[model samples]
Target: MKLRIISSALLMIAIVGAGCVSNKKFAQLQTTYNDLLNQNRALDSKYQIAQRDLSGATARVQSLEEQIASQRTGLAALQAALDKCLNSTSQGNTNISKLVDEINASNRYIQHLVNTKNKSDSLNMVLTNNLTRSLSREELRDVDVQVLKGVVYISLSDNMLYKSGSYEISPAAGETLGKIAKIIMDYKDYDVLIEGNTDNVPISQKNIRNNWDLSALRASSVVQALQNNYGVDPKRLTAGGRGEYNPIASNDSDAGKMKNRRTQIIITPKLDQFMELIEKAPEPTEGAAAADSTSGS
Candidate 1:
């Protein structure tokens, strides 16, 4: 009976020891679980902070990309503007060169016209001097010699050239006509026109109707005398008449009537010279023509 009691006491002590070991192992496991949970929370917080930093970096990158795109657009616009400005400058240079050439051509043409006029004036002066030197003072009283607009005019009184109230050439007129014809023959390039003038008085001659007929007949007589008597070329002579018109003086007095009853010999250069000058004239530019018009006004 003592052996059975000792066995029962030992078994009870083993049971108590087993129960204490189980409680200690369970507490250690709980402590390990709490530590693991705290580590997981800390890791989650770090991951959230990292994610926020990444999001901020992404937003900055997007902003930088947008600025770069806007800068590229502005650069393209500036390039287009620069190219347009360069092209316009080239065109402006071309226009300026063309304008300079036109101005040079116009200046040359103006100088040519001025030179031609000077030569014409010199020739007219020489012709006038020669005619004056050839005629005597007494003969010049009955004749009026002058130069007008590059032409020579020799006006003779009716009394000196014809018989009284007649178209017939007088004996005294031969010396004067011969001397005048000699001077005309020296200038082969000149053309001659014989013009007759009459007073307002009515004619009483036979075969002569009115003043027109008388004046025309007188002009014809002078032209015939130059061609037939004075050995002048008929092709170079033209006959015209002013019956009671183209008078140098009034028809109210006797002296004025005498002056009106006269004949004129006009000498001039051929028509071809004038035509050549006209054909050589250059076409004017728009700017030059406008300037010329403004200056003329």
Candidate 2:
């Protein structure tokens, strides 16, 4: 019995020691696991911060690139404007000077003729002057002419040509239009433009509701009249409406608005050669743009 008790005591002690060692190893493993978890959490926080920073940087880069592109366009426009002003004539100095002298001389003669007409009679003189001539007859009863950029503009009031908000040409105005068309047909070298001007008053008609439409329709009506009567080519004509935007006189008074609101037939030299000079003056800069984009990238 005594020997059995002693063996039992020793066996219990050994078992207890083995159990303590196992508990110690389990504690050590738990502590290492906690440390690894803390390290992983810290790394994730740093990664989130880095991601935000990178996104912000990318947005800033995109904004800067957009501004650069806008600046490039502005620079190109300025360059083209400068080139136009410098080399518009495309002729030698001697030839350009000669043309300028002739134009100036013509202007003097035109002004002298214009000065002879009384202000009260100017309107009648313009209407009856028989185009290309400096003199006028009262029998035709025409309005005054204003010249600009080598084109002459004639003003006709609403009472003379149309009723309020209507595109239908009056019978008297039709006769006037026919006469104008006949003269224009005779002159082949001059390019003609018909522009419609309107007062600040709004349109109240059901057929046409807006000032823009009214202006456009009126201009088109006149153009069609000219074409039908004279067989004028469509290529030589352009119609535009300046609806209450370009009032020649004050709109505060009805009389002034009537003066301001008129269809003007502008007779000028062809702009094809001038436009060709403008179109042919510059390179597209496509390759440069591509290279710039690559560099930006």
Candidate 3:
């Protein structure tokens, strides 16, 4: 529209100048027209740049709106899930309570068993310590007092306890056996197991046919001594023979054979007490049973 207006103005100027206008005035009008035309071209270029900028800005705004919509949708889904979880927790509160009660009951039973085991271990340790403290250093050379797995084991070498290659109790064994028996009598609740071990050598005696006979006879002799001579309860004593099978060392060497020929007096809690404890085990609480039923359902 501006171009057409400018063209009409220039045509009017040419018509008027053809009859009366000077050459200077015509040149001035022509210069004014050229200035206006240049200005209009610059304005057109600016308009095209502004249109591109507006289109880009609109596209960016649209992208941001889409992102905001997606985020809102995600937030709604998470809120719904949280509400469902809260509802479930409220409805199943009784089941949760029952489970907690069951856990507490189990913990209590575990503690009870642990206490029983610790008490038994303490008694065994006391027995071992008392025996070790009572015997002299020379006696200890032939005796080994140890507590293994809550049992007191008094290992007496055959050299100190018996005659050479015989199950007969040595005359020198009297004092040592007396001391041991005294300790055994002090712990009335513990049962004594007299286990006899022997070396791999064969026995040639007419009465003792083999190592098994020697071992059994040796164990029986010790048990009899504890009962008859030292006043240990006969009911609390048990005799067993390992023969040459349960060797502490190799019997190929003389020293090893001597080590292998030894007797172990094992003191432990009564098996009947352990059986009683097993029978008295805690029964399942009502809460525990209810919890199991709920879980099964």
Candidate 4:
């Protein structure tokens, strides 16, 4: 009985020792597993930080590249401008002051021409309006006044100016001519042309030779009346005759023949002022050689 009790106690002690050793081994394995998990987590966090830093660095590099490219373009443009400035300086051999002066002079001359033309156009409008108002005083059945291509044309019926086959002015016609002279005297910058037209009829008079002589004498008589009687400038007067050739109406009927025989006064504005503007403008000098040539001359 004693030996069995002792064996049983030894077996129970061995079982307890084996169970404790197994529990210690299990605890050691669990600790090693936890340490490995912590190491893996730390490595993952470092990899994420490295990836974020790498992305930021890449973005910075791209921005720097773009900035560098823009700088290069600006440098290129500046270099091109410098090259152009140098080329212009060498080729033209002209200083900035001289070039500026020349440009200013050219601009002034062009502006002067524009101003002169505008003034001429305004004057023409005023003159045309005044003449129209003055000529409109006479009845349309007696006379006709019109403006064509900057010239004023005044046409009078044959009965208004002269008698049949005679170049002498009637008393009534002289009064009408005086009114016309007043209009002419208002404008001094115009030339006057007086023309007489006759119908296709054979005119045989004691003093007058033919239709040609009658037409010519009528035009001269009108011009003389304007100059001598009305005090119009003689230099502005011109006379012409169209006998049986230039007619406004056909001479087949008496009314048409009467219409064909008429007088025309044409007034044209003088353009001497425009020509003087051009002649008065300073011409451009060719080069610096102008001074040397002038001195030598």
Candidate 5:
């Protein structure tokens, strides 16, 4: 009987030990479950933040695209305006010689101002064996038609056509300018462009601060001469300033500086082959416009 009782006690001890092991496993499982729940909560929080960031990024991209579209529209309108201003007149004139002579006479005035000794064309006259027999150098300097790059260009290298610091053409220069106006009045088919350039010296005058302003004023002076004196239509003439930026010779030498410091009267035939080609150039893209918009400022 005692042995049997001892056996019963041993069985009870075994059952209690099994119960303790099972409870330990249950505690470990509970810990693992809590950890998994914490991990899931962290993942959900990160996903929410990511979603908000993505939404904000998408909205910004849309706004940028809309702005670009608006700029493209504005650029198109600007281009149209430029074209309307430039291409209004037809290209052709049956009577081109009379206009040609007036242009030559204006150049001659520039030559006379310089006192060109050699028939070397002080007026920078275009060498046309066909138009009129070559005038003597003195005569050529006194009066000659200059053809440059297939267009007539008069040089103002001899003296200051303008008073100090002002774009106003001198009264002496006006008589010659009157001749050019007569040509424009007669030749309704041709176009006129006046280009102004300046020497390399820095100008600090109160009226004209920089070379750009000086050059622009010079061009405007010529345009005014054409319009007021010659009665040429204002629409047909264009004025621009090169401001020592585009010099024909090195500015280091005195002679070169003189050449650079002058105005050019360019008379184009009505065909306008060159200007037509310029109009065909493509407009810039939105990105390019944005990059260049702040450049001058």
Candidate 6:
């Protein structure tokens, strides 16, 4: 009876130990499964965040592309308008020159936008419009007016301005000068350069010795008229005598000689921004300067 009781006790202990081992293995497996579930949830959350960012980035890129395409279309339309304005005539309407200038300025602004990332060109546009309005016309029979790069050039026939072999301006010429003076007075921010040119013929007067002297005296006479008669500020005027050096036509023909004898009044705007841009631009080489010297400014 004692032996049987000892064997039964040993069997009960083995069964209890087996039950503990199986429960320990099941607890370890449950902990591992919970860890894997947590890892999968974290991975899914990261994927959703990445997808949301990609969608936002794609929308921004598409918006930028649409804006660029719209800008290109606007630029094309502006270019066409500029071409039309330049090709049109400057008759019937007195404000045609001003219109053309405004169009040109608008085109330039658009071009600037296309070329660079910058702001407004309002001041330049206003100045150009004022100048165009003051000048008014391109052709005046004996006078020709042209504006380029914000400078105004008025070329008058010497025959219309002066008598034969005289530096005196005729009464008829005073009317034209009066108009010019009014324009100058209206746009008070310009500096005037009066350039006198002559034909190849030799000149001999009581005080004038040569073509240079004649040209100089003629230019001085005009300046005096502007100051004394029309009240143009003397400080704004500069006189230059080109003589027969810068001729527009051949000296061999009478008609050509007539065309060669002219006086040029160059009106330049006094804008600091324009001067700064010009200063920053690349200087012309010696060869280019020589070629340009052949032409009148």
Q: 62-131, model 3: which lDDT tens digit per residue?
A: 6545644554564465345444544686646556556555545555555555565556456645655676
Position 13, candidate 1: lDDT: 48
**Poorest stretch of ten by lDDT in candidate 5:** 90-99
How do the residues 123-189 of candidate 2 rate in per-residue lDDT, one tens digit apiece? 4334434462532232123344444323456555656677777987877676667666766676566
Candidate scoring better on lDDT of 3 and 6:
3
Better of 4 and 6 by lDDT: 4
| Model 5 alpha-carbon miss at residue 244, Å | 0.6
Ranked by lDDT from best down, the candidates are 3, 1, 4, 6, 2, 5
Candidate No. with top lDDT: 3
Better of 2 and 3 by lDDT: 3
lDDT of 1 by residue, 100-165 (tens): 444455455555555545564566556667786877755766776666445678888899999878
Point out the higher-scoring one by TM-score: 1 or 6. 1
Candidate 1 minimal-lDDT segment of 10 residues? 92-101
The alpha-carbon deviation from the true structure for residue 123 of candidate 2, after best TM-score superposition, in angstroms, is: 20
Q: Give the lDDT of residue 141 in candidate 3.
A: 68
Per-model root-mean-square deviation over C-alphas: 57.5, 35.5, 43.7, 45.9, 36.1, 39.0
State the RMSD for candidate 4.
45.9
TM-score of 4: 0.49
Output the lDDT of residue 162, model 2.
79
Between candidates 2 and 5, the TM-score winner: 2
Model 3 Cα shift for residue 109 (angstroms): 5.1
- C-alpha lDDT of all candidate models, in order: 0.71, 0.59, 0.75, 0.68, 0.58, 0.66
TM-score: model 5 vs. ground truth? 0.43
lDDT of 4 by residue, 137-251 (tens): 3334456555433666777787888888889998878777887788778657889899999999999898777888888899999999999999999999999998889987789
**Candidate number that wins on lDDT, 1 or 6:** 1
TM-scores of the candidates in the order shown: 0.58, 0.46, 0.59, 0.49, 0.43, 0.49
Give the number of the best model, judged by TM-score. Answer: 3
Where model 3 places Cα greater than 4 Å from the true spot, the runs are: 1-93, 109-124, 148-150, 252-255, 272-283
